[model samples]
Target: MEIKIKNLTKIYKNIKVLDNVSLEIHNGVFGLLGENGAGKTTLMEIISTLLPFDDGEIEVAGLNVKKEPLKVCEILGYLPQKFDFFPKVTLEESFDYLCKLKGMNNSESRKQEINLRLQEVGLLSEQKKYIQELSGGMKQRFGIAQALIGNPKIILIDEPTVGLDPHERISFRNLITRISRDKIILLSTHIVQDIASTCKNLMVLQKGKVNYFGSTIDLINKVRGKVWLYNILDDEIPHVDLFVSLQDKGSSIEIRYIADNPLQGSISTEPTLEDAYIYINRKELTV
Candidate 1:
């Protein structure tokens, strides 16, 4: 399956929420990354047929998005940033409802399909439990489960790990990767590491424009030899104009930062995906 967008544009309140964006997404995990208000969600909505674009064209499986929306929906699945099932409803019942919505009304077949989706998401054992009883990670996985009921060729997940703990976050990323074969999974998130760990190809949006779009390795290479590390006292830390993240030791703080010219006594370090993201997001500032 493929999604092709050509010079797509969208406006809200006279502001271009998405400005002349173009991308080609294929069968794999493609990432949409940006900070708040950078148009990630808006673009996702447009592709998912929830919102219409003002200009350009979008084609999913050779069907024009604006003209054949119903056909487009038939092959697309989406897990929005926030969603909820019936609080008192059992997980199995929730799947049954969603499957029926997709026109799979046969009870026996739906039951089998529901079990397969739950097992794919590692929630098979929890299907009899009420929706409200699952943990945050389990809920997000359930969201993916419901999305997959119709065997969609494309899946869109927006910020699926926002409130998850570190372990759950990693687990969720792994789940996305596991089920990504032969399908287009568009993972949108403001969190840098989520993109780093899950996506092989990514587009970084800044202020409604494509700041960087290419392979994740290429993006990481943008800031090679530009990352540095040093130690500073927690109470005596200096204000840095760069995107600096700090790790704490017993008595001092170990800081890793990206800069064109690192401070004296700083050790040059290999850049990670996060270092590159911070650099690109703040590129105009450093230059």
Candidate 2:
């Protein structure tokens, strides 16, 4: 499957939310990386046929979204950042309802599909649990299960792991990794670690524009030799430029920052994906 977005633009009132954005995605897991209000969700909404764009074209699975929305919807599944299921219903009932909404009329077929989706997301044993009884991570997994209802060729997941413990985040990532091998999955989030670990290719967005688009390793390599670690008194921390990360160490603070020239007593350090992300975004902030 392939999604082609060309010169896409979206305007809210007079402001440009997505300004001439364009991207091409094939069958694999691709990430849309950006902070809040950076137009990542706007682009995803346009591609999913949920919001209309001011200019440009979006084609999903060879179908033009504006001209054939239903056709595109047939092949698309979206899990938004915030979703609420029926609080009073069981997991199976909720899945069944979503299947019905998706136009699945055959009861036996819906039954099989619901169970299959639950199994795929590792919630088959908990299918009978009430929606209100599940934890945040389980609810998110159930959200994913609902998105897979129609077996869409393209799936869009927005901020799936924003508020979870580390263990739950890893589990959710693993679940997405397993099912994304054969489909075109677009994982959208601001967390650098999410894109670094889950996606092979990603596009970084800044103020509704593309800041960087490439393989994860290529992005990381951009600031490889430019990052350094320095120890400084807590009062001196305010004077450093390009501070990417900071850790408090009692009387002093350890700071990892990006700079063209290293400070005195500072040692060069390896670059992480977060460091690379900070480098790019910080440049934009200064500009």
Q: How many residue pairs of model 2 clash at the backbone? A: 0
lDDT of 1 by residue, 1-287 (tens): 68999999999999999999999988899999998899999998998899978999999988899999999999989999966778999998888888999999899999899999999999999989998898888999999988898899999999999999999999999999998999999999999899988999999999999999999999999989888888887566654557558788888888787777777898988888888888888843321
Clashes of each: 0, 0
> Where is model 1 more than 4 Å wrong at Cα?
233-241, 283-287
RMSD of each: 2.5, 2.1
Q: Model 2, 22: alpha-carbon shift in Å?
A: 0.9
lDDT of 2 by residue, 1-287 (tens): 79998999899989999988888998888999988999999888999989999999988989999999999998889999966687889998889988999999999999999989999989999999999999899999999999899898999999999888999999999988888978999999998888888899999999999998888899999998899998988455644568777788898888888888888899998899998998878842321
Residue 175 CA displacement from its true place in model 1, Å: 0.7
CA-lDDT, candidates in order: 0.89, 0.89
Please give the lDDT score for candidate 2. 0.89
What TM-score does candidate 2 get on C-alpha atoms?
0.95
Error of 1 at 183 (Å): 0.6
